[model samples]
Target: MTSFQQLLTDLGNKSLSVLDRNIPKSAYVPLDLSVTNAALKEVDVSSASKLGEYINRHIAMNEGKVAYGGYLEKRGIYNRSDYFNQQNPETERNIHLGLDLWIAAETPIYAPLEGEVHSFQNNTNFGDYGPTIILKHIINTVEFYTLYGHLSLASIENLQIGDVFRKGEQIATLGDASINGDYAPHLHFQIIKDIQQYSGDYPGVASQKDVVFYQENCPDPNLLLRL
Candidate 1:
């Protein structure tokens, strides 16, 4: 493993959930796309409303407040032609790079560690992160970045670069389907060892060919979430 990867593993042991502790472990459910299911296979996941209803059903069935997306999940939700070619599933960017915490709109999101706002942007593409924030952090002198995507547009208002935030501080709130790149309400949290010259926005999903590289750059968010 890379030294950075080892550092992330170490941080995981000491990190806290990005959500409030009062939410309870029972409020979280692991969502796996690898399972063989007709709902995922046949449903129009690209539509925010459709996906929101699907996620709501999952929450209802499990009695959880949020649904968690596993690392490296082959999510078919990015099949929109604007984001990827619907004609070619093989070339689609369907593999999830970040860990998604699906929840209701306007739900508050917290910082898992002490950091400063590195950058923020409104990536207003049809299937893009509506308003995203990237925070820069240095732990044990190991510099890394944390990305928060699909957030409320208002979260970026009055924000400036280098804005400091404490651990567990309220950083942003979840955005609904209409605003959050037309997807269900969720927080796409990712860790980047190197941002590769990107600012405010980075790829949260990877095509098959680039998945291995992203796997190295963006480690499993569960390391920090611990849920």
Candidate 2:
């Protein structure tokens, strides 16, 4: 593992949640939206409502409140959106590079670690992150970032750069399909070792050709989430 990843791994065996703390870890169940999942063969998730239904059913069947997991997962959900459709296997950006927490709209999202707002904005595009926040965190002299995407519009209305947020503080609430890129309400959490020049936005998906670079730059959020 890289030093940055090691730093993240060393944060805590079980880190804090971006979700509510009252909700125990047990309530955070794993979800598989990868293309390899045979279950999604006939089911369509490109539609926000259809995906929401699938997620709701998954959460209910698993007896969980939040369905999480998707780091490095190859999904077909992006295919339906012209914004993400490239029709090229090698260059198509369908591989999710972040961990997603599937939950209801307006659900509160917290900071997993102490950090300041690096930037926040409303990314308007089909199948894009609506209101997003990027937090800059420095630990043991190593600087990194955490991204919170698909947030409610109100989340960034009054936000400013460098705003401080203590770990576990309420940073933003989840957004609904009408605003959050036409998808089920969920928090797209990602750990970035090097954010480069990105401010309020960063690539959350990777093409096969660029997966290697992204895999290193963006480690599995589970390293910090541990959910």
Candidate 3:
């Protein structure tokens, strides 16, 4: 693990809540939406409704309220969008750079740590993050950022840059397919050691050739969430 990752792990001994605190950690179940999940071949994952149905079933079967996974995972879900792949296999941004927490739309998302808003925007590209928020956090004299994507439009409507949010504070609500890049309702949570010149947006997916750099810049969010 990277030193930053170890720092996140050492931040706490228990899981952090990104969703409503009422939901226990046990309510979260791991999900695999990677290219190797053969079960996807039988389903039309391109359709938001269809893919959502599959995910909902998985959650129900697992007796979980929320489904979360997909850090550095090679996903096929990006195949439908040219924004992610432009007919170039090697350049396709099919590797997810964040951890996705799948849940119902309008579900409240909380701040896992105290932070101030760095930026927020509504990315309109197909398969993009849609309404997104980036929070800057400094702990132990180290500076970093946390990104919350696929958020409801209202989440950014009245948000201001540098707005302070305490740990466990409600930062935003999950957006539905119509506004959240046409995907199932989920929060694309990511951590960045270095955001470069990005603002209100960052690549939540990376090409295989760029995976190494992205993997380092955007460490596993699980290092903090622990779920």
Residue 180, model 3, lDDT: 97
**Candidate 2 per-residue C-alpha lDDT over 1-227 given as tens digits, one digit per residue, 9 for 90 to 100:** 87787888888575677888889899988999998998887677877888888889999999999999999999999998777779999988999999999999999999999999999899998899999999999888889899999999999999999899999899999999999999989999998889999989999988999999999999999888778
lDDT of 1 by residue, 1-227 (tens): 77887777777788487877689877898776543556686667767788778888888899998899758887655656457544665567878889989888899999989999999999888888899999999999888999999999889998999999999899999898778888888998999989889999999888888898999989988877778
Task: List TM-score per model, in order.
Answer: 0.93, 0.97, 0.98
Mind giving the per-residue lDDT tens digits that candidate 3 earns over 90-148? 89899999999999999999999999999999999999999999999999999999999
Candidate 1 Cα outliers beyond 4 Å, as residue runs = 34-36, 86-91
lDDT of 3 at 12: 49
- The alpha-carbon lDDT assigned to residue 42 of candidate 1 equals 60
Looking at model 1, residue 169 earns an lDDT score of 95
User: What lDDT does the true structure give each of the candidates?
Assistant: 0.84, 0.91, 0.93
Quote the positional error of residue 104 for candidate 3 in Å. 0.4
Per-prediction tally of clashes: 0, 0, 0
TM-score leaderboard ranking:
3, 2, 1
Report RMSD (Å) for each prediction in the order shown. 1.8, 1.0, 0.9
In candidate 1, which residue pairs get closer than 3 Å at backbone N, Cα or C atoms, i.e. clash? none
